[model samples]
Target: MPPPLTTTTTTFLLLITASLLLTITTSQDSDPDSDCTNKWIHIRQLPPQFNLDLLTNCSEYPLYDNFCPYTSNHGLGQKTHNNSHSWYRTDPFMLELIFHRRILEYPCLTSDPNLAKAIYLPYYSGIDSIKYLFGPEYNFSSQHGLDLFHYLSKTDTPSIWKRNFGHDHFLVMARPAWDFSQPISNDPPLFGTSFLELPQFFNVTALTLESRAYPWQEQAIPYPTSFHPPNLAYLESWINRVRRSRRNTLMLFVGGGGISANPNIRRSIRLECENSTSLSTHETGYGKLCEFVDCSNGICEHDPIKFMKPMLQASFCLQPPGDTPTRRSTFDGFLSGCIPVFFEEMSGKRQYNWHLPEAEYGEFSVFIPKEDVVFKGVRIVDVLMSIPRVEVRRMREKVLEMMPRVMYRKHGSSLGLRSKKDAFDIAIEETLQKIKSRVEEFAAQ
Candidate 1:
């Protein structure tokens, strides 16, 4: 150990320490907003081929009857009604564009990666993957990874990608994580590119609407709902309407997939709806005990009223597993203030850890194993109706309480009251925290 310092030396060291602490405090408190809003984002300006070019080649986009009308308003489709400007028939794939626009308007964007807590990789992975789905070739396989590697490996500037080996970067996947996962063997002619599988992206995190569970590399965000109220006032009004609305129906399911040849729980749900629903119930002022709006044509269409009506009037919404484990309808149920009854753990527990309180999930949502519903003949209506009335009300309130953060705000409209932090806001905050945790862990390794 060194000898004790003199008074002058000790005083000089104390002053230096105070200055360092002050510098750190100033930097950390730079956002002036809450600690949650302290994320300084650095958005990658990738070559146009990654985002803009893919969008410009709209001729290749064959989804939704070509030139999807829903692409208007930066991915929120046209207004659902002549009167409602806030609500839209938003296309499912519009989250990336919505997020990009939000980033452009973000308060604390940094030009230098050194000042960024997280780097947003604005590659339209969802848009790029769609082109591969209709392809007769696998050429788009590693092109993205190759170009991405070249871009991040540049020697002209300090490489942020090299700082944490991609842990500091993240991608927003509007589609499910599986859509970007390419199988090892193309012998089956896979429907996705190896964009997420490439070595360069192995450590990168993703914000996806649906995630591949087990070894999760992505975070699940809420699937966009049709209603993005113009302001907080509209949102408050809608909440009041949902709370005061008479719930005459016991349970509701609005999805088509019931008549598939493969194993399905919707078929059982359909049979129960057909056999158990009686006209007498409506006469008794209980309305339909159960309701189903068939949408087996491969879409939970963007029509808000058509979907929200039954959910609004029902105590529970049946969100059975679909082609994948997760469903967009679940988010719709949350927005409608209807308690969603999930059939798979992958559907909820493993997906929205960042958005929903995993320990308190039972307070807002219900989960019945798919095995019981599909194989053991557990009737969902019976399971749901068994929930006490007080409990049902409490669950509905919990859902509404957790609602605003799961949705994107109206595009380019700051005209109304908004949630303190909507889905876009939550995603950014969580992404920054996750990156910080990951980078620190990586450094220790």
Candidate 2:
């Protein structure tokens, strides 16, 4: 205070202050709460044909009623309310649009490719395929598919492609992997185009709702459900409600009869439920505390609260393969905190590794093999009743804890809303880790 400071000293002090401020800012940015906030993701801005054009004419799709309006609100579709709380009810097949919208608004998204951890190609492959698959011109699906490949092969910057042959790039599709990766043998004609078989997708990763055994590059993500809670408060409230609610039914099966190719496990379970008798004094018969909703007959409800009410009231929800091994209802059951009972191994265990805990099978769910249920004379009621009450409670708790991870929140909303990671957050984190590991392996090679 006695003497005037020199210019060099003042400059040094300012630099020190700046360094400290930067350190604080960086620490805040790197906090676990801010995990996805600072992540570096590069989205490939394609021509309008790939994404925007498809959305512009969304009504042309066969399921336009379900597709058009829902594409708005960031692919969250229409906002719905339950118990006086607001939430978005989304379409399972609208994930392509939802993911694209989210990535564009993601804080991690960077226009500069040099600072990116991984590249994303935001093509609405799912809806695009739908446009051609259900259109007047069916074979034109192949042409639509070709245009995407051609653009990637010829027009998109060669530098990115040449760098790693697309191993670091990824695409998200709402449809099953098999839809796009149809077997070359046209003995049984497939519905969608074979865009996945193109050379452009060789090393590229595909995030789809259902992944086939072939093409090791596929990653299965959860299908979008009706409930998309905006913040931790809403999610917590829902979890608490499910936790406090009384489960009057022991087990429930809410699907239609299966196709001829695949024996209908739901039908067998329904028969068991229909035959079970309530326990009075000494013995228990089948179907004591069981309920069934035959979706085939339009008896099943689609309203979020009405649908989840039954699932939440049941101890376990029977999840059989619906047309495919995976069903969006599996996630719906999970969202309602209903422990799932799987007949097929691939239905849950083999899928959702990124989002689910890597615990043992019986830890969170029950697996009665389809063979046991069909031919081995194993009764579904008997199998469920065998589990101890304590074990059932443990499984339900595990399911409740997993609710946040399975949900997809609104895109570009406050990061504060993500104190608990949602499905999108987990996907982005896991994708980055996978890309890093793969890049390291490539470098080693």
**The best candidate in terms of lDDT:** 1
Top TM-score hit: 1
Name the Cα RMSD for model 2.
11.5
Model 2 score (lDDT): 0.71
Residue 143 displacement (Å), model 1: 3.8
**On residues 391-417, what C-alpha lDDT tens digit does candidate 1 reach at each position?**
988999999998887777774446455
Per-model C-alpha lDDT, please?
A: 0.74, 0.71
Error of 1 at 389 (Å): 0.9
Q: Give a tens-digit lDDT track for model 2, residues 1-445.
A: 2234334334423543454344334533543445444367777767756765566555545643535556656567667653534456677778877776555545555555666678888787887887656776465444545676667667877677667777788889888887777544454445866667666576778899988765467888888887766666777777889899788788887777743455567667867777764444134322237887666743332356556778878889999886689877788898877889999878877878898755655777889988888787899877888888889899999888787788887664555666778888788888888887777777788
The TM-scores of all predictions, comma-separated, are: 0.86, 0.84
